[model samples]
Target chain A: MNRQHIWAVLLRNLYLVRRSQYRAFSLFYWATVELFLWGFVTLWLQDISTPDVKITLVATVIGALVFWDLFFRVQQSLTLAFLEDVWSRNMLNVFASPLRPRELVAGYILLSLLFGFISFVFVLVLAFFLYALHIWSLGYYILPFVVNLLFFGWALGFVILGFTIRYGPSVEILAWSLPVLVQPLSAVFYPVSILPPLLQKAAFFIPTMHLFEGMRAVVLEGRFDVGHVVWASLLNVAYFALAIVFFYWMLSLARRRGLLSRLVMD
Target chain B: MQESRLPGSVGIPPILKVTDLAKSYKHLTVVDRISFQVEEGEVVGLLGPNGAGKTTTIHMLLSLVKPSGGSIQIFGQELAKDREGILARMNFAAGYAALPYNLSVYENLNIFSLLYGIPDRRAKIEQLLQEFQLTRFRKQRTGALSSGEQTRVGLAKAFLNDPKLLLLDEPTASLDPSIARDLRALVRNKMRAVQGAILWTSHNMQEIERVCDRIIILKQGRIVAQGTLEQLRRQFEQDDLEEIFVALMALPEPAMEQTERPR
Candidate 1:
């Protein structure tokens, strides 16, 4: 729990990203491109849509892309944090030092937050200056949605981390694919009503649905639904709690089995 | 921290104590109940064949793998309870395990220095860079360096914190004979300065003979023999350490079943 140790992990990772342009650029390349592609398409759609629905059409499309990117980033920041050491075969070295497992988690948590903020700013700027869709126009209500999305991402991050630490980099594909699996279920780019009935039923367990639904409520209906926000926030807490519990449980199992360093050799 | 052991058995405590350390994967036991100690200011060589459990032993000591049985203590503190405190004063460098390849020699060392909370960080890094003869390559990416040079950097990082106990697995494996000898000398210098011990594993019997204070030879998954070079030679009636090793390996399973725990 030493702050110095936590900062050490953070600083070391920052140094890793700083030394490699590919590493640094990859952080924003996909986020920026997604925004540009989607932003332009949404902006063009404003003309085809009826005048009454044009604003709603533009807001939801662009907002959905931005928010989805945020959720996607939660996975990247954490998996990268863990994988960076694995790629270098540096896990044995780091874990051998006095650095605690929790410190590693804390450090990556901070890294994810920084990355999330950076991507948020990058998408907002790209969305605004390149296309006229302003995220700020969604107003103060987006704040709660942002927070909820972050925890959902964190929850997913922890689950992937648990699997990775126990099984090795073999499960890395899960880190990327899990979020996309949630795409149709959470209805990222579409409303839950558009989902098949079975998926809509399953979407109840996904907190992202409420957050997205709540976002559309703010933009399309000009209605601030406390029920949706409260539901999303509560589900976020529960999912994240399960994630943390899974993390510690897997951590101890890894320790007991001596899978910690060997798991990351690849 | 036992007063009785401190006063009579040895003045300085054993840097590392692995008691009945064993690890198994359900049906196969990788490390069978092996026990050993490394005293302060000593270098103990851990030698075994390919599947002799050398890596597994190192992994268990670092808590990278959990043991099915036994305990590990460093600096008179159990690793289970004091992993962080024990590890802070310990470092590991292996010829096979690499530093961050993309990181410069200096940056890699800097990361370690901070993690260990080493005081006077800049000076310590500069000292290690110059000492390891890596000053010229301080800014070079670790991956870009020659294997010999990378080994030097790995050792340099391990020494950055002035650790009390260092685990070096085939640290001289990748280097040429001369560079390996120089690296061995560097390790000796650190051992003297820090009053530290090292658990070293290597295949080079000559190098082990020259660099180590004692040796533990493992076979299958257990320690078959251990002692200083001279003592081991006397025990086996062999003139050379490698000959002793050859003879020990040739031992029948039933004979080696009775492991000689060399103090």
Candidate 2:
């Protein structure tokens, strides 16, 4: 991969965000709103519960929201960065350059990492200041869970990218909706045990499901489960590989069908 | 009439060699076995009506649209295998394709220069801005610029790499006559200086006559005629290039198809 080409794509998107106040503000908008909304819910739940369970309620709920937002934001960062080129009718110029497909993908992934980490930290700080919820209390276990969530988010991001490339912007709703559609299956707000038996079985295939389950194990039982991390990592490996294949397949199909040109013209 | 340099006259291969290139979607054929060449220091105008496959041809050359049959060799490498390597030495500009609207003119050029891997990006950008008369507007957002100014910025970005092969698609369609003339002169000077090749597409016959060393006219995705102005004039018995273009465009489909095949 050409580092210069990758850096060029990343720099191009960064310049867009840097120049526009609305776009810059959007980076933190949803994360902050979700933190506040869920922070209040954590407080209300704590007030109603007995003192013993109150702390558990705060950490579990707030941590889930924070971690879930990481996944969502990373996915959005990638899809939005790509759509920026499409919306500007700049795809032709971009693809016409020496930037390889892999390099372009690398650029989007790096953009997602940059934006995702920034929003993750912003929301973490906001949760601390507003609700006194300490995510760091989850200990070193938080690191693996965070990495697993990022992998799953990237997997989902690539899937959405493939769909957008295949169907054009008409299906951009999938970018916003697909992650939400996977939310229930992921059991972001609840344990897999609370899900129906059928969904529980289906959720086993979702890396986020394994990740959140592991996060709850640490928060509630103080048990750092290595098995959850292993399962999530293995599943992430499969899903991420599949996503990359799907993405390249869709790109080749788009080129053969002249969909790339259509997307530019449209 | 301009003198046409035959390919390989200087013992150098053509910069672009497209052989029997074809693209079809399902049952519909868009580009039908078209073959052409553009030599170094030459400007070849690609003329055709709307949907006559000019844009598709350009897209195929860029590898944005995959060709169903045939090959494209650029800089002595096959485009299918070394797309990135080939594209590094090529650049394209179009009236319809735009830079990111939110970025300033300078930023847009800077980003493209980086994409092209230009070694002296800042210097090249500054020079291109002055060359395109866009120095004062460097800080202005590309979207806020007037259409004509935007076209100039696009041209400047196209030159960022000092590309060996430049593909221009109706580049001056939005420019005023004076600006268009200046752009033609600038392109000619650049070509002469660098020994580069350009495959240009323009509906404006006068501009083509002024800039193009040879003309390839397409009708319904087939090359109906191709030659220097004098040769084309003599073949069609028409003095004006525009008149030749109109007569070729006015031909019925049957006659145009017949022209594509040997009589």
Candidate 3:
């Protein structure tokens, strides 16, 4: 389709999220709870450590929260996306349209990233007043973080999308839980090296580990870890490419088997 | 392909043409060796029982499902290769299918307008809202609308860009009789006015006879009879279309029992 069509599709999705207050309310509640839960930990640590150590600890925590929200919440976002179509049975209309499978996927991931950006901005603004913790050079680092987050989230979101498309709605619970389960494995709450050797090696395979590391290094220490950023970016690209291939292949198979129209039946 | 001498046979290509189309699941053929061509400005009914592969055939036409064996050309272009081109000129609607409910009726229609890349979307949407009698519910959520209203919205969304090929599945499934009649008339008028073709699926034989120029009766994934209502009636030794439909859906064992009774 043309550029105007793509923009209309994109804007329409955003408007839906805005009108329903579903995504916005989700972000608000999630951010508020995280702020209080993490805020307590920051306070507890400050009582035990010197001012410099406390500052470092808080910065890492904030960086970790950003990565956590992006990686772990991605599946939730995808579930929201797929569920809307399934619950309303509107998927048939979309599948009937001329929009390419790739275009629909791109539109969805872009929406997810857009929502992620909103959450990031909302938390940042609320954190300023709630915690008084200043994130140094945030303006410079935000764009890169978002770019990385988009790739990473879409890569993770695709696996869930594939499952939903193939196995149907029963797997949605697993889809939501996957993100939360991957949090610790992704090194969002701690360093990858701190895990068991086997787990640490396994963590290296996840795209988010490198992202959280790069984010923590840059935002917390004012040190941009170029090697980590490059590695993370490459890993995300590879994962996203693999997801695209997987989805298209499944779609072709589904079409050949005439299972695509049976999407609602299953 | 042989070109038939129908009216408006000038430059307009057939809306849909399929050759040796086939689809099977687990070695069981659902749509086997089906071949049909729908000309522009024609409405064809796909009539069959529950598992007779009507939906499967439509899916193949829409490219929602790929053919196991043959070719599908929409507007004279292969669907697999010219998907976007073919799809942009087509639209589909069904009662069981709903638009994105989280979106308002207006936003839902607007999104589809955008998806189809219709120019002057606002004016077009307004015209559709008034035409579909959905003007008052423009800003209301789609989920809140009754099933009949939702189907109307679906229809409005489908025809928003005046698709050249429209695939409708039970277009009047859950609507009241009055609304159903209205929709049927609207579809007929639109098809006549706009050089479009419709592939409609329904069990309503009266509606079929009233609206369809041709009908394809499918049984067990194969075409049992296909022609205009008059042609099918004479060929089947039936006075009406309903008898032919019953004979197609009828079981063989009961006839054996009745014959064996020898009353």
Candidate 4:
């Protein structure tokens, strides 16, 4: 929990983003393209639908997309930060320092918060300027939804990190694809009701599913559902706890197997 | 040939102490029950063939690899319990373990200084840059630098916190001979200035002969021989370290067993 060490890990990754154009582009590129692609799709939906359906469509679809991106970006930030060290063969340098594993994680979490918030705001502004959509219009419930999505994102991030550490860089595809694997189960684009009954039962365990369901309730029904928030929070608590345990377990196993050094050295 | 004081000669604990340290993966023992010490103001070269466990030994010492048996105590504290605190007073550099390539030399050093929590980071970094003759390359990306320059930056980063114990693993492996010689001199000078302990690993017998105050040679995960350069040369009946190393490698396992000397 040394702040200086945590700041160092965070600052090192920040310097990487600040220096490399490709890294900077990758951070914001997909999020921006998603925003624009969905922005126009919502515009087209607005033109086709009646005025009554039009207002809800933009807020529902675009807002969901923005919030989903928040979760994805946060998770990606964590994995990518770690992968940066691995790719540079700098993991030995990092782990050999005074910085603890938890401190390195804290740094990645901070980077996620920074990147997530920036991209969130960036897309929000774009949505506002292009389509006159206001996410804050969803009201104070946005707070809980954002918080739940972020926690779930971090939970998924830890799992991804755990896998990467255990298996090495060969399985890096999981970083890009794991969140997507969770997407359908999360019910990000639609209601859990639309999912098969079996998946709906499975989705109940996913905190993001409840948060997305909760977001729809706020946007469409104008209903403030405390139960959704409570369920999401409880589920997030369990998932996040398990995720941290998994991450540390993998790290301990890696040390025992000499995988940490082998990952960089090989 | 420098004669070295034995560990604990003056009642001060060696900066690094390992007793029966061992690491095994499944059925393979990479580092056998090997024990050694590096006292303050000493440079001990860990020399072995490619798979003789030098890197694994270094990894275990760093706690990057957990030993299956035995203990590592640094600065009189157990490494497992005080890894962060112990590592704060230690640093490592390897040619294969590089600084972030995309970052500039100054940025890399600055970030490492922060990691080590060095006060007066700017002054320390500037001094290292000047000392390593890397001032002109400060703003250049580390990846763009020559192999020798990159090794210098790596060395500068290693010295960032003025670690009490420094572990160098083939740091100049890729550099040209002249650059390697210069780096060897630089490291020796720096260690002397700080009166720090070093556990160095290299295949270059010449480099080890030039830089190491003492040498510990590992063969197949066991310490085959250890003493000053003069002692090893005498024991192996060779004039130069290269010949000594060649003779050691050529011996059968049973013959190698005969050469084992207690530290």
Candidate 5:
């Protein structure tokens, strides 16, 4: 691959994300809604907790919400990409170019990350003002948060995008349903510890539990949850690897069955 | 000027060459052992019916779909090995594909221009906008453009990098007759000054006759006939290109055109 060419593809896609009204509004809404909800919770719930506990709890909620949005954003991007292309028959046009499937996947993932970052930062800033809480761990946790969120989203994105490519019209409902199942089990609103023993074991397998737990540790306790963060990151990487395999498998299967052409067929 | 001369000054080689190309899906063969050459400054039209595998052949050539077996040399290099190098000097335009609809026309062109890494993109984009009459709609979202206008934008984008190879699929598909004529004129004028070859696919026999220097008729992914417009006309003994197309498409082939539907 020409590095510059790939960069150009990456940059152009980022610009598209930046230019889209829906994308911009999504980030704004995500941030604003998060601040509104959690900020309201912080004010009303303040008398029940100490200052440090309040900041930590608020940070944890906002952070979880960011990842929650992150999950949905990836699914939306993947499904919508297929839907848009199908609408205009532009997918066929893209497949007609020399652009590799991997490059296209990478571009979509990168765009999703940018959107994720925008939402994360938006909520972070708004929550800071509304809750009057110091997000002290913002300096250290943001990068990891972004990285973990992208790996999870992109990994899931591959599976969703792959399914859409193969069984687009029929399996589209799964696109919406996926986040609902994954996010609730991610232990965003509550600790995994609170779950029943069997469910707690399952939650440990979920990458999101580690992510939320890690954020809580850093922002709430003023210390890194090295074990959980590292484990989550590694698990995420593994998930991403599996997602890639799934995507490639789907592509090959589609090609073999002549369904790959459906990718470009409107 | 004398010092500027270099040894073996052949300039750029032919932009595209295909040798013994063949592709099949499962037991069904789509493109069967076809071969062709495209030099700079040539417009070659690939014509066929719905299921003749015209699109499949183009897909193979562009490396969008991998060929079961064949060799494609683009810009004096094997396309399989040097995709980016070859693609850097190439562009494609078609109605079925477009810039992201959510993006404005300017942003869309900018994204493509950035992909091509064309120097001085602002100036290039301004010129293209003016040339394609898209300047007035630069900020308009692509989804909002009329079919004819969108076709113009697509055509404009194809020429953005001054590519050595331009592949067009129904370049004037939905445009009104007058606008189609204008696009043909634009393409004709642009080709005159550049060392570029255009591989165009279209169902419009009249447009093919008007714009293409050569024609290749594919029946079930195989080239049934290929030559200049006059040659095709004389071979079929038809008065017009459309009649020749009708006659060729009417015949039975390995893959029936009736079974394959057009989008």
Candidate 6:
């Protein structure tokens, strides 16, 4: 992929982010609101906890909140970035340049990292100052778990982008809802034990299941489940590979079908 | 960026060369067995009615559409193998495709310049901003611009690289007369200065006649006739290129005309 091309994509997208108040507001607002909603609830749960409850009540809620937003931040990073191109009708312009298909992906991947990190900083600071909660309080080793969730978000993002490109805007509703559809299976909030046994079986294929399960272990039981971490990492790589391959396929399909011109929004 | 040139050390090859170019969907052909060439500094007009496969032909040349059967060689390099190299020296604009709505005109041009790896991006952008009279509107969102202003911006973006081959699809549709005249002059002057070849598509017969050195008229996915304005006028016994175009559209080809949707 061309670095200059990648930089061009990034530069334009960031310009959109900087210029549009609505876009910038949407990026920062959701995480802050999610933090507040869960932050107060965690405080309420801490008040009513009994001795057998055993878990650090606030940490579980706060960790789940922070990491869920990380997953969400990257998801929006990838999905919204693709939508920016679609909505602006800018895909044809970019494709006409020397930028390759993979360069588009590379550029958005960089934006995902950039936005994901910024969201992380904002949410982390809010959680710390408001609830006196720290992700560090869980342990520095949770970094891998965070990375796994972010990759999973990126994977889901590619799937959404693929569907949008191949099917056109008629099915772009899939882009917004697909990630949330996986959330129930992901077990982002409650334990995997809370899931029905059949869903438990399906959850094994979902890497975030392993992550939330592993996060509970670290935060509540004071143990790092290397097995879950390893499983999540391997699945992250596998899913990410498949999604990217599928995305490239969809792009060529869009071109061959003469559908790129009509791949616009209403 | 410095242009990535073909191996034209001794003599310049045709700027664009297409051999047996055709496109089809299943059994339905959209563009059929059309061949053409454009030389250095020549502006060729691609004139055709709606559904005549003019857009499809342009898309194939840009590698945006897959032709059912054909070969395209731009600057003596095969398009399939040298797409990046060829596209780097080429740029296109259509009234249909859009710039980012949220980006300012300056940001949009800057992004494209960086993508093309232009050697002096700032100077290039500043020059275009002045030429398009977009300097004052540099900070305005592109979507907020008036239609005529947007057309100007589109043209400005297209000319950013001073490409050797430029493809314009209804490029001046929304421009005022003065702006349109200036843009036509720009295309005219670029060819003299850089030997740039433009494959321009416009419904305005007057505009095409003014700018194009040679004309290729298509009807129902096939090139019905092609020549200089004088040559075509002489052949069709018509007084003007517009009349020649009207006469060509009157030909019988209902089978090719309506069987498939314009791609």
TM-score of each model's chain B: 0.94, 0.94, 0.90, 0.95, 0.89, 0.90
For each candidate in turn, the interface RMSD (Å) is: 1.5, 0.7, 1.6, 0.8, 3.2, 1.4
Please, what are the lDDT tens digits per residue for candidate 4 over residues B130-240? Answer: 999999999999999998899999999999988889999999999999888777778877877778888999998877887787899998898888998889878888998
Cα deviation at B57, candidate 5, in Å, is 1.3
Query: What is the C-alpha lDDT profile of model 4 across A26-107, one tens digit per residue?
Result: 7778988988898878888889999888879877888889899999999988888988889989998888888888888788
CA RMSD, predictions in order:
3.7, 2.1, 5.1, 1.9, 6.4, 4.6
DockQ of all models, two decimals each: 0.69, 0.87, 0.64, 0.87, 0.28, 0.63
Instruction: Give the least accurate 10-residue stretch of model 1 chain A, judged by summed lDDT.
Output: A257-266
Docking class of 5: acceptable
lDDT of 6 by residue, B208-251 (tens): 88778778888878888887777787878998888888877776
Where is the poorest 10-residue window by lDDT in model 2 chain A? A257-266
- The Cα error of candidate 4 at residue B58, in Å, is 0.7
Which pairs clash inside model 4?
none
Candidate 2 lDDT over A63-116, as tens digits, reads 899899989989999989888888888988988998888998899889999999
If the candidates were sorted by their lDDT against the true structure, best first, what order would they fall in? 4, 2, 1, 6, 3, 5
Docking outcome class, model 2: high
lDDT per residue for candidate 1 within A138-215, as digits (tens), equals: 688888988898889888999988888788878888878899888888877788998888888899889899888888
TM-score-better candidate, 1 vs 6:
1
Prediction 5 global C-alpha lDDT: 0.72
Report the TM-score measured on chain A for model 4: 0.96
Worst 10 residues of 3 chain A by lDDT: A70-79
**Docking verdict class for candidate 1:** medium
Ranking by DockQ: 2, 4, 1, 3, 6, 5
lDDT of 5 at B130: 95
